[model samples]
Each structure stands twice: as structure tokens, then as C-alpha cells.
Target: MQVELNSIWQLKDLDGLNDGLYRVLQLYPQDQIVIVFPLVDSKTLQRPIKVGFEQLNEALRVGKAHLSSYELPYYQLQSEANISASHLAKRNEKYSLIADLISSPRFLLDLVEQPRIKLVSLHAKKHNTYVQNLYRVLNLYWKYGQEKNALLPSYKNSGGRGKSRVAGTKKRGSPVQLSCPSFQAPEGVNTTESDKVLFIRAMKQFGLKGEKVRYSRVYDKMLKEYYSDELIAAEAESRNALIPSYRAFIYWIKKLFPAEKLIRKQTNQGDFDRNKRGLRGAATDHTEVPGSCFELDATVLDVHIVSEFQRNHVLGRPTVYCVVDKESRMIVGLHVSMEYASWRAGRQALINSFTSKKEYCAEFGIEIEEDDWPCNHIPQRLLCDRGEFICKDAEDLAVPLIGHLSIAPPYRAELKGIVEHRFNILNEKLVHELLGTTKGRSYIRSDKDPRLDATFTLREITKLLIDEVLEHNSSIFKDLAKQSALIIESNLPPTPLNYWKVHVEAQRHALSRVDEAHARSRLLPISKVTMTSKGIRLNDQMYYDSSHSDFNDWKVIARNNGSWPLEALIDHDNSSFIYVRLEKESGFTRCNLMRESVNFSHRHQADILFFEDWIKLEKSKAKPTAKSIERYQRRNQVIKSAKEELAQAPSLDSKSERTNGMKARRREAILAQRLGEEKPELKQENSFSEFDVYKEHSDHKKQKVVSMLKRKQVERDEN
Candidate 1:
């Protein structure tokens, strides 16, 4: 057998030689002898041995020696990807020195053929000691497959990594430095086995628990529990010198307990599972395609807004509900209203998502083509938080529109991170810069109030939000867009709209259509409305009228049998119309507010409710005023005066007399009251007419008297 360079040979039962592995460094074919070196520690320099080819072949045939290929250990095979920049640079430097020695065949053969000691002496004389032994370089080159990375230092074995050192009398770490020159630092103590036990006990007692505890507190507890009473009674300096320091305790605690373990133990199980745990998979991994899943979430906007009707009246922050597609990260639907974050508001958002966007945008005075914002279908599954989508009503409505309803566990916002993150984007991109924005106001002390700065009405803000949504949907989303295989194949820019369009064209979407009216009726919140004699009363404030055939009949029945309640679906965003269900089997009947409730037309239920609350507040404020008190006092006085008059008035002698001339007495009293109340000026103007009437009576009497004894002179005295 011929001995080849860089071939490792293990001698088993060789006489007069220790059995070990050796590498063939150089071959001398003319002499039939090979130069070989022991593959031992690179730090030790060993002279190469010359072995005859016949002798190696005879040993191999006798099974006393074996030929084996050299393989690098796992730790020695470091890839460039895993290497740090500094370590890689160091490795490259080492490889550069020996690059020619390993690569050039003639130079390597001539260099390794020289006598080993003479070679080392020559290298040392030339000051070219990149390695301790030139023969060891060849040994490693042969051992690790002759790669540039083969020269990398075994840093993994340095610094006693992952090994605990035995405690001794001498200190192990840097000495503590005192901040003040006058202060004396405590003498360091080696962390003994007992101290490690104390640290473990303290960490298990305090640090590793649901409630977060300070390391300082844990150290104190350990010192109190483990230190003897005599040690505790010692001076602070002496006690610290005898016992382990807080820093030592911390070092051991960290060594025993990893950061992840401590964090898991110190945080709530839900919080840890939701936020601190590693994300093994993505939301898109579960959503197979666009519209496969929609995430719903609502947030109170940072900016204050005014009422649509009254711009000067700040309506406070409005709740904005957003629906995001899990696969494409598109803002499929949105609802902004003064209503609080409730199922009612979230339902409107879902309805908006399921219906066409063209008409919805038109309502906000924004004109756009169908393709500009073309997310108008129900998703196969809906993922949402426990807030709005966990209720029975939501389950009933949403489970039908979306085939599956996924209610995320409480406190896990990451489950609906798609929509929750959209809210942050909306606030950052659009809301934070708007007038009356409350962002950063918490830390500001300026006299300017965000509420007072509110200039945009609810409608104006809604329009702006629609425009933002359009822009956001069209904007390029680098992370989400580039993740799509279809978009990459099509070489399209990764905007949400582009991604959605690509998938839709490829028929890789799970969107389904539902009747708009049916979706609206099912998703809108349901409430009970009373059918009264006057009209259908809603919330006992606004009344509605339906033109159905049974409307009048229901009204008649209600009037005769007292007010009755019927189930109705209300769109909280619009108080103008409500869908009323008169019968169990019948569909929802559209009802408009009665004429009496015209004031509440085109208004939100929140606005009407707020107005009612404002009115109540005003009444409450007015009730305690001086004028109100005086009015009540006057009313009491009138009652007292009427009681006094009744007491003074005479009683009828009999019931028969009281009824005998009731009509004549009433007429007389009315005539007396009219005369007493007549103005003086009117009385003077009528005086001449009265006198003329008296004169006519006298003349008539005189004429009659003349016929009767001529002259009684009608002296009738006009009597």
C-alpha cells in the first residue's frame, strides 16, 4: 500500500511505539519513505517520523495498523454564517498566513520534506511563526480537510464556557470599587457551594413566581434566611465580607435560571403565552389565501372630533373599528363613529366589510372605482378579540356571514395583531397629526386643550379616514407583499391592493358574497321597540313608522291593549331607520322615524343619547338654581292662597240650592268679571255709545208716556 499525504494512520499494536493516530505529511517516492507527524495538541511541537512503504503495508496486512480519513470535530467545523465578524476576521488573518503553504503543491512538498527540527529552527530564525510548529500546521491542514476555515481558533473551548469553577480561598472576579474615596468596599468572598444553595433557595422563593420581585429583595431574603445570627450581628462591612454579595447571588441565579425561564415565572401565564413566547408560526400560515380570514379590532382614536350637526361641540374621541385581511394585510373595512367600542360598532364594521365599498365611500363624498378599494366580501373565518365578537349576538350574526368565528383569548392582542397593528398605523399615519389629537398631550402642560382644538366634524373626519384607507390599501407593504409567491411570480409591486388583485385573479381567494340587506339585518344590533298609541317608540325618545299592512293594525291593537314591544334591529350609526320584525317568521320591515322625531333624522344613536344626557344634565343644573327655588316658593304660596280662599268662602245651605241656579250664577259672575277687567281707555271710548243708548231709551219711553197721560214727562227720568 502506498502512503498518501494527509492520510491519517492509526497504529494499534505497534512494537516500541505508543498506539496513536498520525498523519502522512510528505511522500518520498524515490526513497519509498513517508514523513508523518502525530496528530496531537497543536501547542506541542513533535518531530516527524519517516516510515518505509513496505513496513506500513506489512502492518496494514497484519491488522496491527489501520488507514483512516481525518474528520474535523463538530465544534471545529464553523460556517461563515454562524461566525461573528470579529472572529471571522481573525480566522481569515490566520488563513492568509498559511494560504500558500496549503495550496501550492511544490512549495508545500519542499517545505514539509525538510528535517522537522531544522524546519522549526529555520521558521523561528525567520520570525515567521504564524503557528508554534510548522509540522502542526500540516497536521491540522490534513486533520480538518485543508479549508481556509480549518484554521479558525477553537474559541468555543475558551473561558471555561458552561463550566462551574470550584470555590477557593482566593477571590475569582474583579474587586468591587467604591464610588466615594472615603468609603471602604466589602472584601470579596468566593461563591461556595453553600452560597449557591442559598441563591437557589432565594430565587425559587421570590424571583421565580408570578409576581415580579426585585433582585435586591431576593438577595436580602437569602442573606436573612441563610446567614447565622452571629453573622448578621456583625458589622455591615464584616457581614458583607463573610456572606455572598448581591452581585454574586445574581450571577449564580442567572447561571441556574435562564432569562426565558425567569420571565415565564415572573409574568402572568396568559401574558407570557401571548407576548413573551416565541412565535413559532405566522397568522398567514393559517390563512390559506386572501379573505380566508379577517381580523376585527376597535380602538378609540387619539384625536377628538366634533358632532356632525354641531361643529363647536366636541364629541370627544370616536371609536374606529378596522377589519384587516390576514393574508394580504388589507384594510378591507372600517367604521368610525362617536359610539363607544361595543358589539354594535363592530357589527357595522363587519357589515361594511361584507358590502360594497363604492356606496359607502360615496356617502363620505369620496369617489373611487371598484378596483381602488375592492374588498367587499365576507371572509371564510373571522378572528377577533373577546370584546365584541365573543357575545352570543355576535356569534349568531357573524357565524353565518363568516363560516367560522375565532374568538381570541382574553388579553392576547397578538391573536388579532393584523387589525390591532392597523390601528397603530392609522393613528401614526393619519390621526396623530390631525387637530385635537391627544397624542403626546398627556406629557404636555400647555394651555391648549385638544378638545378645544377640535375643528373637524365627525363627517369630515370620516371622509379623511376613508381617504387614508384608500391610500393605505394602495401603499406598498414590503413584508406582506413580498411574501406572496404569486406576486413574486407576477413581478408586481407588493401593495395590498396588488396582492389582493393578484390572488383574486389567480382564483386563490376565499371570499364569498352575501346579500347586502341580509348581512346588514343579521349583523346590526337588535333591540326591543315599543308600539304605542302615538307611534313605534324607540328608546322611549324617538318614534318610527312602518308602511307595512300590519302597521296600522299593530298600532290599533297597541292602542286598545296598551303598548306592546317588538324585536327590532338598529343601526347605531344611523338613527333615521330601524328594521322592525313584526312576526317571528317575517323578515325585517324597514321603519322610518315618525314626523315627530324629525329632529333626530340622519343622526347617530350616540348623538341622540348624548343630546338626551345633555338635556338631563341641564335640567339637573337648573333644578338647584335660585330662580327654580323661587318658582317653587311662589307655587307653594299660590296653593296656600287658594286654600285660604276656600276656607273663607261660604258653603251652600243645601245640595239642592247649590244646583238650582248654577248656570245663572255662573253667567252673572262672568259679566261682573268682564266689567271689572275692562280697560279705562276702552270704557271711556264706549261712554258716548252708552249715553246714546240711554237717550234712545228715554225718547222711546217719552213717546210711550205721551200716549199715556201725555207728559209723565217721560220724566221717566228716563226712569
Candidate 2:
């Protein structure tokens, strides 16, 4: 092998030379001689020695001399920009002195041709370095690569960074100050191995997990447990104990246990994962376009609302459900109802998201163009919380509408943060300012009750919510990070409407169209309703009927036999109609509430169920009343008296004897009953004047004769 300059080699079994690693400093191939520098673990400079080329070649041929791998220094691997400015200035200054000599072509030749002692002496004199700075710079250059940055000072090794120093007898940092002259402080003590053991015990017992006690408490407990004797003596003498300070204890604790590990130990797994853990990625990383994913969640609003039927009767806070698109951060659907947050209310929100919004807004008395709040398509995937979506029914119903249903783990609200954050925006913007808001009254006493001030009905609150949703859709998004190509090209503001419109126009959305009737039927909650002879019965309270041809036949069959049950889809928000699946091959048929269940029409299913339960409870309460028991006993007594009267009468021996004088007895009984009743007396009247009476009689006779003549004439005309 050919020997090159600055190449390290291990010399073994070499004649008249000690076995060690050596580096070739200068090469003289024409003279058959070379200068080698010994590599050793010492900062002291070693003199280079000249050696014959043939001897080195023979050693290498026999495998006695071979190239050795050199590990790079830490400073060599670091970037030059990271080095301190002072260090860089000093490095440049050192390199400037030896620049001409190193850049010359005869520098290596001179190292081989000139005597080593004379060369060192001349460089020391030329550089005016009595302490051998010239030799140090040259040595660093040859030890590392032949680069200017190689002359940089090793300042990283000077301060003993990242290393623990052995404890001395005295203190380590500046002395502490006393608050007063009478108050004595502890004699500063350096941290020792024994003190560290006590710190570990205290941290494990009091500071690490279970209950998060304060650091001061841990320090006090440590002193009481580990240095009790010293503490007692100090207290007795009116002085402080000679123990490690709280700062030193905290230092060792942090050194032993990391902050993240301590946090995990202190909190529960769910809390730590939800609150303290670092976010692994964004929720929208997998979603490429609008409608790719949607988040569904519900929250109880802060304001109280009144019932639609009775405005004076204040219903408690209403629950609002919002579905937000993950890509655009837009609320695609919204629902506000008196019912609590459950699957019954959640499905209404989903139905709103999958159907048209024009008619829905119109029903709320908030007319809007289609583009005002235009989000009426099913998403590819739906992400929801575990409350309403972690059930078999939710999966069975929503999976077919939206391509997939993803339920987030319990307590992990961040998984559906898009919708969860929308609740805060809504409360801040609208609900908190309402008349009967309970936002700040939860923990404090107020002069007036919020319920008494409630004025907005449920329908009115819903209209306000729809208006807010429209405004939110058109408002600019403050935290929108991802943008589509079409949005960037058009340079539109980052509003949900803009993002949605541009993507839809370019056909970059993942929205899919579904039949509104099919979606509504599938999303409605299913329950068994009896097919009765009168009509279809729901929950044994509400009755329904359909105009379908088979319904009449089914009713007839039910009348002949017993009532049979069938599965029907129920819309909990409105009891006016229910969708019934008659056959496997047919779609759902709409059934209207019957006249018998007219009280339940336009009422919430929850209200109807509540009424039924309340009525049953009232009946149960009234059953054991004293009045009811007395009435029952009085009826039994009356029946007993009638039976006795019947027994007193004689019995007929044969049918002929019983029927002998039935008609005569009935007439006699009728006459006897009439005779027992009283009759009214008649009154008489008379005239006193004779002339007046005679004149009245004459005029009456004349009128009668004229009438007779007129009647005869009429008869003759008819003949």
C-alpha cells in the first residue's frame, strides 16, 4: 500500500520501534523516507521522527502496519455557525499566522527535508510564541483535517458541560441572605450522595404521584423524616439545620426524573393523554377536501328558553348539536331542542346535514339563499364523541349514510375539536348575551333569577341560532391553516363559504348526494308500534294511520285476530308523523297521527312519554285514597239491597205463568205511575163591556163570511 500524508496506521511487530498507532505527517517518495507522528492520549506535543519507506512497506505487506479508523471530534461534526463569535475570531487569528506557510508548496517538503528541532525553533521565533502557540495550531490542523475551522478552540470541553462535579466540603453557589438579623439561615451544604437518597425517597413518597403535593411540603417532610435529629437540635438552639437547601433538592429531583415522566405519574392515564400529552398530528391530516370528514358533538347552551306552547313555563337550558366540516371548519348542520343531548337529538342534526337547508330555514322564519348556508351532502367519514356514537344503533344507522363512522375515545374531546370548538364560538357570540343566560350565575348568587327573565321560545331561539350559523359560515376563519389549490389560485379570503364554493366548483370535494327521504327514514330512531284494529298505536299512547292500500287490509286482519307489532321509524322532535316500513321490497310509508292522538300532534316524543309516565304515577297515587275505598264499598251495598228486593218478589213456576198478564200488568203499572204524578190547573178570562163585545162579535162574523166566500171562489176556479 502507498503511504499518504495525514493517514493513520497501526504499527505492530515492527523492528526497533514500539508497537503503537502512528500518522504519516510528510511523505518523500523520491527519497524513500517519511516523517511519522505518534497518536497518543496526551495533550503534550510529541516530536515527529523520520522513517525509511522500505521498512514501512515491508511492515504493511506482512499486515504489521495497516490503516486505522479515526473517530471524528464533537467540534468537527458541529457547524461552524454555531461556534461562538469570540472563538471564531480567535480561530481566524491563529490561522492567519500560518496561512502563508501552509499554503506554500514546499511546506511539507521542508518538514521532511529540514531538521525537526531547527524547524520548530524557527517557527517559534517567527510567530513570537514563547508558549508554543505556533506548534499548537499546526498540531490541531494535522490532527484533524487540513481546514481553517480545524484551528477553532475547544471551548466546549473547558467548562465541563453536561458533567457532574464531585462534591466539596463547603457550599457550591453564593451564600443565602437572611430576612432579619435575628433570623438565622442554614449553613450551606453541598449536595452529597446521602442527600440525593433522601430526595429520591421524598419525591417518591410525596411529590411524584397519587396526590400532587407542593414542593415546600415535600421539603418539609424530607427534613422531618431524614434529618429529624438535626432539625430538632436547630430548633432547640434557635438556628437553622445543616442540610441541603430546597433549591439543591429540586435540582437533584429534576436531574433524576424528567418533567414529562413526573406529569404522567401524577395524573391519570386518560387525563394525561387528553390534556398533558403532546399532539401527535393534526385531525385534518387525512382529509384532502371538503366533506372528507365531519365532526359531530352536542353541548347544552348557556341560556334558558321557554316552551313553544306555554311561554310562561320556562324550559331549562336547551341542548344544541353542531356538525362541523374538518377541512373548512364550518358548521354544516345545527339543531336546538328542549330535549337533552342524546341519540334522538343527534340524529336530527345528522338529518339536517344530509338534506336541504332552504325549507329548514324557512320553517324557522329565517329566509336565506341556497349559498348562504349551503351544506347538504353526506361526508365520506364522520368523527363523533363516544356519548351518542359509541352504540350499535348509531353505527348501524350512520354507517350507511356517511361512508364510515368513527367514534372518539372517552374524555378525548380533542379528537372532534372542530365541532367542540364551535360550541365555544356560539356561546360567546350569542348565547351568553341572551336574557336568561346562566353563564356567570353558576357559582355566585344573583339578585334576580334567570328563569324568571326567560322570554324567547324554543322556536325563536332556533331561529336565532340559524341566523348565527349563517353569519359564522360567511365570516373569515382565523385559524384556517390548510388551503386548496383552487382557493390559492383565486386568492379568496379563508371563509368556510369561499373554501366550500371554490372546491365544489372545481369538483374537488368529497361530498356525495343521498336521497332525502331515504336518509330521513334511516336516521329516525326505530321502535315497535302495534298495528291495532283502530289504527297503529305508538307507545300505547299515540295512534297513527296510513293511506297506503295494504294498511286497510292489515287493520281488518288485526280486527279479526289480535293486534300485531311492526317496526316504525320515529322522529322524536315531531310526533305528527312516523315512517313505517311495510315490506322488505318497499320504502317507508308516511303515517299521520290519528284523531284519538290529536293531543300528541306537533308535540315532542319526550313530552308524550313523560305525560304517559306522569299519568300512570297519578293513578297509582290515587288508588289507595279513602274516598275511592268508600265509593267502592257504597256501590257494593247498593247492589246488595237490589238483590234482597228481587228475592222478596215471588218466582214464576213456568213460562206460561210468567207471561200470562205481561201486557195488562205493564198498562196497569203505567197508569199507576201516571196517576201518582201531579197535573197543572187552568186559568179563565172575561170581558166587562157589552158594546165592545158585540162590535167585536159582529166584525168576527163578517170576517168569517168573507173568508167562506173567498174559499168557495177559489174552489170553483180550481174545478
Best by lDDT: 2
Q: How much lDDT does each candidate structure score?
A: 0.78, 0.79
lDDT of 1 by residue, 321-388 (tens): 89999989999998888777788788898888987898778766688889999888989888887878
What is candidate 2's lDDT per residue for 380-498, written digit by digit as tens? 98998788878788888888778788888888887787788788888889888999988734735656788888988766777898888888888887445355666668888888888
**How does model 2 score by TM-score?**
0.68
Cα misplacement distance, residue 558 of candidate 2 (Å): 9.1
The window of 10 residues in a row where model 2 has the poorest summed lDDT is: 679-688
What's the CA error at residue 68 for candidate 1, in Å? 24
TM-score of 1: 0.63
Model 2 residue 27 CA deviation (Å) reads: 20
